[model samples]
Target chain A: MFRDITIGQYLPGESFIHRLDPRTKILSVLFFMVGIFGLKHLYSYLFVLALTLTVILVARIPLGYLLKGLKPIFIILIFTVGLHLFLTPGQILVEIGPLSITLEGIMKASFMALRLIFLVLFASLLTLTTAPMSLTDGLEKLLAPFAKVGLPAHELAMMMSIALRFIPTLIDETDKIMKAQKARGADFESGNIWQRAKSMIPILVPLFVSAFRRADELAMAMEARCYRGSEGRTRMKQLVYRKTDLIVTLGMGSAMVAAFFFL
Target chain B: MIKIDNVIHTYKKHSDEEVQALCGISLDIQEGEFLVIIGHNGSGKSTLAKHLNTLLIPSEGQVLIDGLDSTDPDMVWNIRSRVGMVFQNPDNQLIATTVEDDVAFGCENLGIESGEIRARVDDALATVGMAGFGNKEPHYLSGGQKQRVAIAGVIAMRPKYLVLDEPTAMLDPRGRQEVMETIHRLNKEEGLTIVHITHYMEEASQADRVVVMEDGKIVAQGCPREIFSQVKLLKSLRMDVPPMTELASILNEAGLEVDKTLLTVEEMVDALC
Candidate 1:
C-alpha cells in the first residue's frame, strides 16, 4: 500500500527529457504553468493540453502514472462539478423541480477541472524527469543571485537536499516502528477513530525518539567529515547547461507566448 | 599506534548515584592488530570503544591516535578521521537510501572530490563483497548486508583504525558470519587496526589479543589461547569461556587429555574424536 505513495515522484529513465538540464526543465515548467493559467478560451486550453501531452509522451512516462497522481484531488473535482451544476448562475441547460444545470456553469467547471488536471500533470512531468539532488543543485545555482540580496541560497538548497535524502530513510523507520508496535498487539485497525488516534501514540513516541537520535547521529557524522557548509566546498557533479536544455526552454517559451495571443 | 593513558569515564556525574563507566582503563593497541574486547553489560567496553574515535571524551585522562590527543579540540577531526566507528544497530548507522550512497557518506563528509569519492566507495563495497549493490536500496538489504554496508561506509573514509561496538549483537547467525568475515578481511588483508567490542565468546577467540573488562576495569588481557585457558577467571568475571574450552575442561576433569583453549567446533571435534 505504501509503495503506491511515491515521494517526489522521480521516475528513472534515460529519455531526452530526463537528460535535459534541471534548470531548463524547471524554468520551462514555470512557463508551462503560465500557459495553463493564461487559457481564457477553449481553444487555448486544447493547445495547452496538446503541449502537455506531447511533453509527457516525449518523457516516456506511462499515462497511468499521471492519472494516479490525480487520485488525491478526486473529491475536490467532484465537489466543484456538483456546485457548478446545481448552484452556478447562467442560462439553464437542464431544469428539475429545484435544480438547474447552466451552460456557462458547465463551461466554467470544465475549464477549471481541465486547468487543474494539466497543472498537476505538468508538475509531475518536471519531477519525473529530474532527480531530487539535481533539482536542489539547480535551485542553488538559480538562486545564486538572491544570495547577493541576503538570501542563504546554498544553505537552503543544502537543507532541501538533506531533507530529500532522508525521506526514504524516515519512511523505512516509520514502517519498522509500526511493525514493532503491531508485534506488541497495539491495535491500529478495528478501533474507533479516537482509539486509533491514541494507538498512534505508541508509534509516534518511538518514531520521535528514533528520529531525534538519527538527527543527532547524522549531525555528528557530518561534523566528523568536516562539513563547514558551502565555503571552500566544491561538488563533484558540477551543473552545466547543455544544448537540449536551451532548445527545450526556447520551445516552451515560444509556445507559452503564442498561447497568450492565438488561443 | 593507538594508546589510552588512564582514561576514566563517568556517567550522570553530579547525581547522587553517579556511575563510573570506565575506571582508569589503559592499553596500547599496535597498528594493524585485531584486538577483541569482551565484557558483560555495563562493563565499560562500549564506553571504551567510543573513546577510540573521540565519540566521547575521558573525564580524567586522554586517548591518543598516532600521538594526537582525542580530547584536544583541534585534533578531534584528525582523530576521528583516523579512527572510524560502527555502532550496534546497522539501521541507525546507515544514513543513505542506496548501498553505494551510504558507503559514500563518510567520503562525502571528508569533502573528497567526486572522482575520488566514487573510486573509494566502489573499493570499500568491493572489499565487503557488495560491489554491484551500489544502487540497491538499503531497506531491501538483509541484516548482514546492511552491516557490511555500514562497514563499507567506514572503510570508504580510509581510516587507519576501525572500531565496532557490538555490531553483530543485532544480527542473526548468517549475518554474524558475514560481518565477522568482513571484519577479519579488513584486519588481515587491508592491514587496518581493529578494536571490536563484542559479548560473543566465539568472536573473540580469533583475535590477536583479547581484553576482558569487569566493572570498569581490565581484569584480563592476552592472546586467545592464554585468555580462554583461564576458564575460572573468566567465569568469575561473569563471562563465559569459549564452548570448546568449557568442553575441554569437563573432559580434562573426567581424566581425558584435551587442549583447554580449543576455539572452534571443528577443533573440539577433532580433539575429542
Candidate 2:
C-alpha cells in the first residue's frame, strides 16, 4: 500500500492543465499560493476557493484522493485552526475561562486554514500532473541562472531526479525485507511502543546495509557508463513551454487579479 | 578481450586478519568468448569479475581490458565503457521508474545524444524481448523481466564485453532460465564477450570455458566437461559438479560404463541407456 504513495504523486491525463509545461504548472501554483495569502477579505477568499474547485474539476483528480494525501497533516491543520481561534485577540464573542473566541479570531482561523488547504491542493496538482523527470528538468531550468554563482544547479537536479527514481525501488525493497523477516517469525505488530520500535531493528539494519551497498554499486555503474557530473549532459526530453503554458499563466494571473478586487 | 596478469586483490589491508580476495590471477579472455567463473562463497570470483569493468582495481599486478589498464586513472572510463557489468539484484541496478528510462540510463550517462540514446534504448529493450513493456514500471514486471531489463541497461551502452556477477543468484528457477538464455543469446548471436560469475554448476556448464576458484586462486580452468569431470577436485574445493555429472560419478562407482562428461540430465540418460 505504501507503493500507492507515488514519489511525485502525478496522475496521468490529457487535460489541458495536465498537458501544460511543468515550469508553467510550477509557476501557476506559486501564483496561486501568493493569491491565497493576498486575500484581505471574505470575497477574496471566496474567489480563491472557487478557483481551487475549478482547477480540481479540470484536473479530474478525485477529491477523495486529494483528501487522502492531506490525511497525514490533519492534526497540523487542526492545530493551526485551533491556535488561530484561541490566540488572535479581538472583541471577545465567547469566553470559557482562559479561552476566548472573537470575530477576528474566527476570520483569522478561516484565512489560515484556507490558505494552507489551497496551498497543498495547488502544489499537489503540479505533482499529480507532471512527471518527476519533467519536474526536475523544469526545476533545473528555473535554477539554471543561479549556476553562475557556483550553485551546482545541474548536479542538484540530477540528485533530486535520482532520489525520486529510487523512492519506489527502496519502498519495494523494504517491503520484501519485511516479508522475509516476517517469514522468519519477526514480530512487527501487536507490540507496545518500545517493542514495535525494537522490531524495526532487524528491518532497519538490513535496509541500511542494502542501501549502502546499492549506493556503492550505483556509483560504480554510473562511472562505468561514463557519468562525469551534469556538464555536457543533454536530456532526451527537454522541457519546453508552449502556447498552452502561456494561456494557463494568463488564466491564473487573471484569477489572481480578480481575487484582489472581488475577495 | 581481457588480459589479467598476476592480479592480486586484498580487502582490509593492514588488518589483523586481512582478506585476500584474489591472490594472483593470470589469464587471457578472447573476444566473443563466453567465460564462466564458478566458486563457493568468499572464493574471490566476484572480485575477479569486477576487475573487467574497472569496478575494482587490482591491489597488485595488472588487469588490461582491451589493452586499457584498469588501474590507470585515464583509462578507467575507457575500460569501463568497453566492459559493462550487471549485478545480482536487478532492483539495485535499475535507476528509473520505467523500463525504457532504465535502459536509457546507461546511454544517457555516456553523453550520447537524445536521438541516439532513444534508438539504442529501443534496440536494447527489443534485444531482451521487452519492447512492448518499455513504458511499464519495473515493479510491475516479474523477476525474470526485471533482470532482463537490467541486461538491457547494460546492452544500451553497447559494451564489447559484459561481466555479470551472479546475476541469477537471487532469481527463481524461471527467472534463472530467462537470464541464462539471454546471456547465451548475447554471447552466441551478438558475439559479445561474456564473463559470467556464478555458483550454479548448471549455468557454468553452458559456457565456452569454465574457471573455478578457491581461496583467491583459480584452481581449475578448462572446457566445462574437462572441469566438471574432476568431481573429486571440485568437491575438495567445496564446489559442486552438475547434477548429471555427479550422477555419472555415482554410477561409475557402481561399475557402470557411463561417460563422466555428461552435464545435462537428458545427456546422462542417453549415456546410461
Candidate 3:
C-alpha cells in the first residue's frame, strides 16, 4: 500500500525541463509558488495555472501519473475547501438546514483550493524533473554562501541526499519485516486504532535496530574511505548553469514581476 | 610492505570484562602478494584487517604501512588512502545512487580534479568489468555486481593495498565466483597487494599464502599445499580445508595412495587416474 505513494519520487525523462539545471528548476518552482500566493485576482491565478500546465507539458510527464500523486492529499484538500466554505461570512448563495454557503465563501474556497493544487504540482514538477542527488547538489551550491556564517552546507546536502537514497531501501526493508512479522501471526489490520498502533511495535523495533546498524556500518565505511567531515572534498559532477537555465530563470522572473505589477 | 608488530587489539579495554580481539600478532605482508586470512568467528581476522587500513588502532602495538605508523594522528588519512578497504555489506558501503558515482566516491574524498576523477572512475569501472553500467542504480544491481562496484570504488583511489573482509560472505555461489575472479584479476594484472579475510576454505586455497587464526593468534601460515597437508592440525583448530584436500586426506588415511596436499579437484582426479 505504501508503494502507491508517489511523493519524493523521480521520473526520468529527456525533456527540456529535465535537461535544465536543477537550480533553475528549484528556483523556478519557488518563484512560481510565491507568485501563485501573491495573485489576488482570478485572472492571475488562471495565468499561473496555465504556466504550470505548460511546464508539465514540456516535462512530458504523463498527466495520469501526476494526478495520482494527489490521491493522498484529496481529503486534506476537501477539508480546506469545506472549512473555507462554511466559515467565510458573506452573502448567502445556497442554504443548507443550518449551514449557508455564500458567494464570497465559494470564491475564496475555490481560489484556495486552486492555490493548493498548483503548489503541490509545482513542487512535484521539480522533483519529477531533477534527480535527488542533483537537487541536493543545487541546494548545497545555493547555500554555500551561508557557510561563512557557520552553516554546514556540505554535510546537510550529504545527509539529505543519503536520506533520499535510502528511502526506497528502508521501505523494502519495512515490507520484508512486516511480512516476516505477519508470518508469525502478527496482524496489522482488523483491530482498533490503538491496537493497530500497538501491533506496529513488533515492526518498529526491528526496523529501528536495523537502521541503527546500517548507520553504524555506513559511518565506518565512510571513514575507511577517507571521509573527514567533507573538508576539501570535490565532487565528480559539478553543477553548472547553461544558456537554457538562464532563459528559464529570466522567463520565470518576468512572469513573477508581471504577476506583482498587473495583479 | 605492511608490518604488524606485537599488535594487540581489545574491545572495551576500559571495562572490567575486556575482550582481546587480537593478541600479539606480528606479521609482514609483502608487496604484490595475495594473502588470505582464514578463521572462525571471533578469531580477530576482521579486527586485523581493520588495523591494516587504520580503522582501528591497536591497543598495544602498532601497524606500519610503508613505514608510516597507523596510529599517528596526522598519518591516519594517509594510511586510509594507501590501504583501501571493501567491507562485507555492499549496501552499507555504497553511498551513492548510481554505479559510477559510487566508484568516484573515493577519488572525490581524495580531492582529485574532476577531469582526472572521471578518467580514474572509468578506468576503475572497466577494471572491474562493470563498464557501461555507469548510470545504473546500485540497488538494482545483483549482489556480485554491487560488490564489484564497491571494489571499483576502492580501485579509483589507486591504493597500493586492497583489504577485503569477507566481501563474498553474503553472496551466492555465482556471485562469489564473480567477485573472486575480479579480485584475482586485479591482483595478477594490476599487481595490487591483497589482504583478504574470509571463512571460505576454497577462497583461501587460491591465495598465494594462507594464514589460519584460531583464537586471536596465527596458528598456521604457509602455502596452500603446506597448510592443507596438515589436516589433523586444521581439524583440531576447528577449521575446514578445501573439499578436495579433505577428501584426499581421508583417502590417504583409508590405506589409499593419495596425496593429502591436493587442494583442487583437478589435482585429485589426475592423482587418482
Best by TM-score: 3
How accurately is candidate 2 docked according to DockQ? 0.60
The reply for model 1, stretches above 4 Å from the true place, is A80-104, A143-187, A191-195, A224-228, A253-263, B13-17, B251-258, B265-273
Instruction: Spell out the clash pairs found in candidate 3.
Output: none
Candidate No. with top lDDT: 3
Candidate scoring better on DockQ of 1 and 3: 3
Q: Compared with the true structure, what per-residue lDDT tens digits does model 1 show for residues B5-60?
A: 99889878666677889999999999989999999998999889888877789998
Give residue A28's error in model 1 in angstroms: 2.9
Q: What is the lDDT of residue A124 in candidate 2?
A: 87
Question: A77-135 in candidate 3: lDDT tens per residue?
Answer: 99999999988999999899889999999989999999999889889889988887889
Interface RMSD of each: 2.9, 1.8, 0.8
For residue A173, model 3's alpha carbon misses the true position, in angstroms, by: 0.6
Q: Single out the weakest 10-residue window by summed lDDT for candidate 2 chain B.
A: B90-99
Q: Which stretches in model 2 have alpha-carbon errors above 4 Å?
A: A1-7, A173-205, A250-263, B13-18, B250-257, B269-273
Prediction-by-prediction clash tally: 0, 4, 0
Model 3 agreement with the true structure over B123-181: per-residue lDDT tens digits: 99999999999988888888999999999999999999999999999999999999999
Score chain A of model 3 by TM-score against the reference chain A: 0.95
For residue B192, give model 3's deviation from the true position in Å.
Answer: 0.9
lDDT of 2 by residue, A167-224 (tens): 8778888999999999999999978999999999999999899889988887766766
* Each prediction's fraction of true contacts recovered: 0.28, 0.57, 0.72
Q: Each candidate: RMSD to true structure?
A: 3.1, 2.6, 1.6
